[model samples]
Target: MPRIPLVDVKAQYAPLLPELKQRIAEVLEEGTFVLGPNVAAFEREAADYLGVPETIGVGNGTDAIVLVLNALEIGRGDEVICPAFTFYATAEAIVRTGATPVFADIDAATLNLDPADVAERITPRTKAIMPVHLFGRPAPLAELSKLGLPLIEDAAQAFGSPAVARAGVASTFSFYPTKNLFAIGDGGLVAVTDPELGERVRMLRFHGSRDKVTFEYVGTNSRLDELQAAALRLFLPRLDGWNAARREAVGRYAELGLGELCDLPTDEPGHVYHLCVARSAERDRLRAALTEAGIGSAQYYLPPLHLQPALRYLGYREGDLPETERAAAENFSVPLWAGIGAEQQERVVQVIRAAARVPAAS
Candidate 1:
């Protein structure tokens, strides 16, 4: 058998080719590439899908975060509280905007930002709270709301996850090719409950231009192009089904007792499994075993951002973030892509189970 892939994008694309091809051809005929009708349509559709008032397309997920922060006027001397256990982009966006990134621990079971810890970390400088729907589980939004700060939902991984709830704040999503609701390439969207804030994001995403020649503020170039927008428009309607398939894979992993050896993800009522991850005491050993067995698994993030050498200036120490440190050491992601087959999933579970049973050295 061929080596089990990490994400089977090709498998998913094969079925959608006819429609995808026609859409590309239509864009070519129009020759109106930048932020054209396709982009507007996608924005509308995505907003409706997310059940938000408005959605603004941008260059990518990172820019989506930065643009929203910009619109909120969060800059120098401000502090944005975010979980340290997420992809670096979460805190990186805060740093880029000249704000300080205040690291908070995540909930051990869900791996989402711990709202209680967030409240503990808030200071006079606190400007916003960025809660990531890590591994497709929404953060504790109900608890975070009590803080009364702007909440930026990092919905990059939880695109179609049912855990997405109205946090009465702005949210951002990544449409990178691998995401649940993806485009052909890099793309992003910003969804906001506040209408005025939504309009500001639109301006910030396009060089802060209010009109063609009228620049209202200094902003970066971060507009989503027409080609990617068209592709996403075609793919959006299928998001729920794709997410359901991923959930089924997760169910199979659970039924096989993989959770006993490896810590399988927990399902909340509203969650949509993005990349089903698990915790293992011997993460590296299990990863090597799976690779040798022709099953592809990945370490989502081996080192938490607080411990990264580049961020030493942030004045963090090893013991400063206990939960983040533990998560970094133990977590690894398995293939839960929409089109991953059951046979492939079985092989993957077998390899992981075998690896987990191996004796650890003292």
Candidate 2:
């Protein structure tokens, strides 16, 4: 087997090289760089694609979350219920806003924030619920909506997934090179149905000024660069097709009986399959076998966010969140980028099967 990467962005980008070069040339020739025509154009296109009225592009995904919270007026001593199993940025945004980030447990099935756990954590201080669509599947918006608090979707991994953007008060997207819809460098977008909130993000991204000289609020300079926007425009048209390809690769894993060897993700329509993850008590051994076979694998997260030392002040212990703790320990993602071939997939399964001798817990 040849060497595989956990995410082969080069494989996904190669076929579109000519178009990327052309678009990048146009941006250079125009010279209207920061938040220029290309940036505005991508915002309009992304808004249409996601079924939201507006999309405000930002410097990166982390800033997108911060912009959304600031617009909502959530700060200082307030609480935001966020899942403990996600990237630190979700909770970090809250901390930066001076709000307490109350960590919630995740559902073992979807590896998403558990609604019941979320309800248990809610208090008068709770301002919003940020349900992360972890590993490219939508979280339970229906149940979360019933809680009567606004929802902010951390959709960094769910860019092309169906109905994910439509579920929350505001949905955030990351265009880091690995995401389904991405740029050559880091970029982000915040989509919202409400024009007022959309305008708020627009102002918040550029030092809180509606006009160039007037500073209306305490905001940061975090606009998306026109070059990255132009590059992303090249891939926007092919996003669904690429997402379909990832889904197909995941199906091949099921067909090869990899599920019996480890815990597999569900084949849900809303899932864009960012990472073809599975759980195993033998996860470490399996990763070693894949490495020896020149097949790549990664632990999506080894320690859930609540237990991370940075958030130790949150006062959580080892057993505070049982499911989140277990997920961090047992789960790891396998190689399944959009352009991966069946032969590469077969090698991944073969290596795992060889390593999964003991019966794994479901």
Candidate 3:
């Protein structure tokens, strides 16, 4: 069997080659490399697709989160409550803003932030709650909305997910090469429901420039380039179909009954499966087995953020987040891309099943 990649970017690109080539040629001809017409066009299209008034393109997802925090004035001594089970970027963004990350446990079933636990973690210093839609599933938006705290959605894995309007704040998306609605390289965007907040993000992404040459505030250099934006324009319309295919694949995997041995990925109405993950008692072993069988499986987050060495200053200790710790040890993600074929999926399923049936001693 051929080695199956976790994401077949090449396969996806093959079909879009002609259009991609045309877009790149246009960019090259115009010589507008930075935030130009293409970038603006993509932002508008993305905003419409996400059902938001504005979407500001940025350098990457991490920057998107940091910019939002900065715009919200969530700096020194502020406590940002977030689940420790998500990617390091979520917690890292909080720390980057000079704010403290108050770790909360995740729901075992959804692998998302537990709203009850999040509410419990909130103190007077709590300025915001950043809920990550991990692997492609939407976080418990409805439950989290009742708190009335600022909600910065770490929607890096959920670009095309069904929109769940939160009461307090904005949602951030990543267009990293591996994301569901990816760009050629590093890219990100922010969707702000609040007009004033959205305007602030636009300025923050471009060196806090209120005017052409006047810098109003301290800001970072993080703007999405024109070439990537153009590519995204070519790809945006296909997002729904791609997401639908992922859903179909998820259904097939579930029907295979592998969930008996491993906890299958769950959905909540409007999720777009960025990655189809599973929880297993023997996660590490199963991952190794899949690799040996030429199947590419991944561990979404092995070391929960609270347990990371860099986060020691936050005062978190071992067993601080029991649910997060449990998930970090057992969760693994499998290939679920737009270009995945039926044969490849079947082979992946077969290998995983075979791996699961093997005894640990062997």
Please, what are the lDDT tens digits per residue for candidate 1 over residues 1-362?
A: 68987888878778999999999999999999889999999889888887888999999999999999999999999999998888889889999999999999988788878888888999999998999988788789888989999888888888876556378478889988878888888998898989899999998887789786998988889999999999998888888888888889999988877887788888877788878888888998999988898777888655788887767899998888888888888888887788788888888888887768743222
Checking candidate 3 for backbone clashes, the offending pairs are none
Regions more than 4 Å wrong, model 3: 164-168, 358-362
Backbone clashes under 3 angstroms, per model: 4, 0, 0
- Looking at candidate 3, the ten consecutive residues that score lowest on lDDT are 353-362
Between 1 and 2, whose lDDT is larger? Answer: 2
The C-alpha RMSD of each candidate to the native structure, in angstroms, is 2.1, 0.9, 2.3
Model 3 earns a TM-score of 0.96
The clash tally of candidate 3 reads: 0
Supply candidate 3's per-residue lDDT for 78: 97
lDDT of 2: 0.90
Error of 2 at 348 (Å): 0.7
Q: Tell me which of candidates 1 and 2 scores higher on TM-score.
A: 2
Q: Give residue 152's error in model 1 in angstroms.
A: 1.0
For model 2, residues 138-157, the per-residue Cα lDDT tens digits are: 89989999999999999998
Cα deviation of 139 in candidate 1 (Å)? Answer: 0.8
Best by lDDT: 2
